[model samples]
Target: GQTPLAAGIAFAQKYNGTGEVTVCYLGDGAVNQGAFHESLNLAALWKLPVIYVIENNEYAMGTHQSRSSAGYPLVKRADGYDMAGITANGNDIDDVREKMWDAVQLARTESLPSLVEVKTYRYRGHSMSDPGNYRTKEEIAERKKESEPISLFKERLYKEKALTEKEYEEIEKEAVMEAEDAIAFAESSPEPEVATVFEDIFAPEDHCPGRPDRGVSSSDRKLAMAVLTMREALNQALSEEMERDERVILMGEEVAEYQGAYKVSSGLLQKFGAKRVLDTPISESGFSGLGVGAAMQGLRPVVEFMTWSFSMVAYDQIVNNAGAIRYMSGGQYSIPIVFRGSSGAGLQVGATHSHTPENWYANVPALTVITPAFPDDAKGLLKSAIRSNNPVCFIENEKLYGFKDEVPEGELLTTIGKARIRREGSQVTLIANSASTHVALASALQLEADGISAEVIDLRTIKPLDIPAILGSVAKTNRVVIVEENKPFAGWGAQVAFEIQNRSFDDLDAPIERVTGLDVPQPYARVLEQAVMPSAERVTEAAKKTLS
Candidate 1:
């Protein structure tokens, strides 16, 4: 399940540890993949500290490079990317080392990525399964005789009087013995235990102080609260975190000079200066991967996508690299980065620009996904996300940015996995988050008029599900209705429905019903969009069905 393109991009993007250079070695065949082109484009554009070493052995598996790729030489392809390109004789150890060292120096000092194609040959077949049927035996024999790396180097050493025959033989024997010992150790190892199969998917939880059961303290309530828009609240949170920790930086399109597309980062550049609040090119893949690299180098980076829809460009880096880096590296690296932006259909923007991605990221185990309902949760949760030692996908709604609500003063950190019961009742449970939380609250008000007490739960965090709160509410109500703006197929509501049925099946009096967006591309027209999105009426109707 390894994507070399994504892995290489991730490595180059984040390999700035201790000002060291990252050299990514790949076969000539990888250049054909789209991710390879994308990665190179970003690296060259950003002047990233990376060296891409393409080992061109003349053939890609059974096909010759001439037949498979375009252009004269593979290194020449770097011209289109506006980066330095060079070639070296792979059989000449000194030549290869000099080229590689030059590439490393350029990347480290100039902040430029280089392409180095080593002219080489592989004597054997591509793999053990291959029968060496594609090339002539004479062609292979000629390569071994004239250009084999080891034999050519040994002869050169002897001609230079670098070592006597006996000394060379002793060195070869020691090398063989070391390799044999490594093989023996590997062969003696036992298979991993079956119980350990699920280990290391996510780092062990470093839980914050606040838990749902603890409830807000009386002294906590006495803290000052300000009525601020969701955008202002988020801005305040980012501002506070930046002030608290100088390592925290923000980067995205229009985040600096233009303030923000949604004005969520207004005044940040004025306060923190250009370096901390950077405005990047409109390349999501480039900037997002850069943030990953920056975070890997012991800095806290907050990367904002103009819209979650634009995040598709950087999906590979986000899901494959940021989500898996910690686990893949055996907890050696922590991608303490936040990828946040507006999500879900609300504006009349076409199908491509609208839609919620909470479920998409929530499906990832190593990521923490948060979709807060009100301004207070928005501020608190975003602060927590910034402080967290894990990759967090903070989903905000475009429709709710201007919506105003009260937020607590001073340092506030909402627990990542906790759900708050916005309104408590005992008849039926209404579950939702973000913009849809308001829908559930409205539905509860109508249900109360009809003499049905409905409890409303705002699932602040999507992953690390608050199963206890969900089960407790469903167990009391004995009936349930889930609401969400996302489509029904594999939606967050469906997962909530399954959780209720799995643990509170006996307590339920009726099957759970869900009110969600219609299974179709969101319409651009206002009337059609309204018809498709979940409304208070739809949720109330579903709640009544559960009651009936």
Candidate 2:
């Protein structure tokens, strides 16, 4: 609830360009949540043009503020983050208006976040079902008499002669009539069609799937054969895209000053300036949500999660908000944001730091999931993801970042949800993506030595499944073995296996086999980690088994 509110503030601060100030109003209860502090800290740290207003009505759903909060004068909490803090008399409209205007102006001009606490008292119980049992009626009546906001505003307006008593009565009558009209309209409104609920899951007319035709001339070998590492390829793509679009921005922990945790964004900050290439604080949900908001407001944001392990912390913002916002808004908004980072295990980082969450991301409807295997794909697919009109989870492998290969030069873009035939053969099709594609490629060589002609397919994009490419490969081979680093249970390979079985069951010569990671947390030991991951040896064996 309040998390969305904070997310809205963070989004607006980063994305809103109309010079219109964004103010997020939250109840006293919201301040106790971790997201509240996380958002405030990020807002202050980033110096975002945001105003956070806390409605300190003193009760967090029947629990008194004194019981829940540790300190008095709630505005003082802003001091901890070195943010500007002020208290306003909520009962007086002049005080409220003046404080809000000051905070908004400060945020807009200085790009500084401020906290404005409006001290007020609730006139009624927390909800309709509850009675006035928590506090005395005398106390409630006394506070209402002393600090009623509407009464105070009316009194001031009357004293200033802004309206005559007759005009005030007419205004009150007009308000009542408008409220009655709204209620009448609601009651008379027709029920929505059942099909309407499913119409807005993604932007209409944006879900076509086909292999990319990046205009690479077959005769131009020089442009198509420039060797680069995955890091270099990604950097080049980011640079080209940022140069092409003024609204494209990069933000994440260590993305600016440190040039990305993996150095993939090393030269971007210097090239784009600190404003576009932002180095955000270690608040994944805050920044990710901020990116979502910015995307909604017409900016293309590339948010790097140092790893998907850290992105798990921002799952709510990513899945619930980013994935669903377009559908929830009935296709009125398209979230053109990319959440990318190094993913997978192999660096002895233990279970927490290493996880292939491609399956998790792919599970969400309307999300475009990409796991590029090599340098060319890393560059091309990332460029496509940046240009995509949907939220994309671009999964990059840290293990493959250093590996080098020739990538096409000049402007190149790959299609999302397309699979590439890496190595062609006749016997069995081995499907993989990201780091596991290397294993499949290696296994293909081994299979050749064993006299088994294995066709290897790199599933560049995971979400759309590229069923046509896979079916085409399956039709040729009649046998299949999928390789992936994700665990055996509910893994991406499992989905592929199911689809292959359903779509190409008659084409199959054997049951679909899968070479996947062991169903356990990635271990810390080098040998053990290797054991849990899919390997060339395992994939080779699985390919042979499919033939046997």
Top lDDT hit? 2
lDDT tens per residue, model 2, 1-548: 33433544455555555566667889888887766787788778767777889999988778889999988888988999999998998877788999998998898788888999999998888899877688889988999898888777788889999977898899999999999999999999999999887787876435333234532112224455788999999999999999998778998989998999899998999899987898887878778887887788778889999998899989888898899988888889888899999888999999999998999989999898999998888898888888887899999998998999888777777767778888888999999999898899899999999899998888988898889989998999999999989988888888898898888899999989988899999999999999899999999998999899
Q: List lDDT for all candidates, in order.
A: 0.84, 0.85
For model 2, the superposed segments whose C-alpha errors exceed 4 Å read 1-17, 123-146, 151-170, 204-223
Number of the top TM-score candidate: 1
What CA RMSD would you report for each candidate? 3.1, 3.3
TM per candidate:
0.91, 0.90
- Candidate 1 local lDDT, 106-147, one digit each (tens): 977777889999999988889999888899999999999999
Q: How many times do residue backbones clash in model 2?
A: 1
Error of 2 at 264 (Å): 0.8
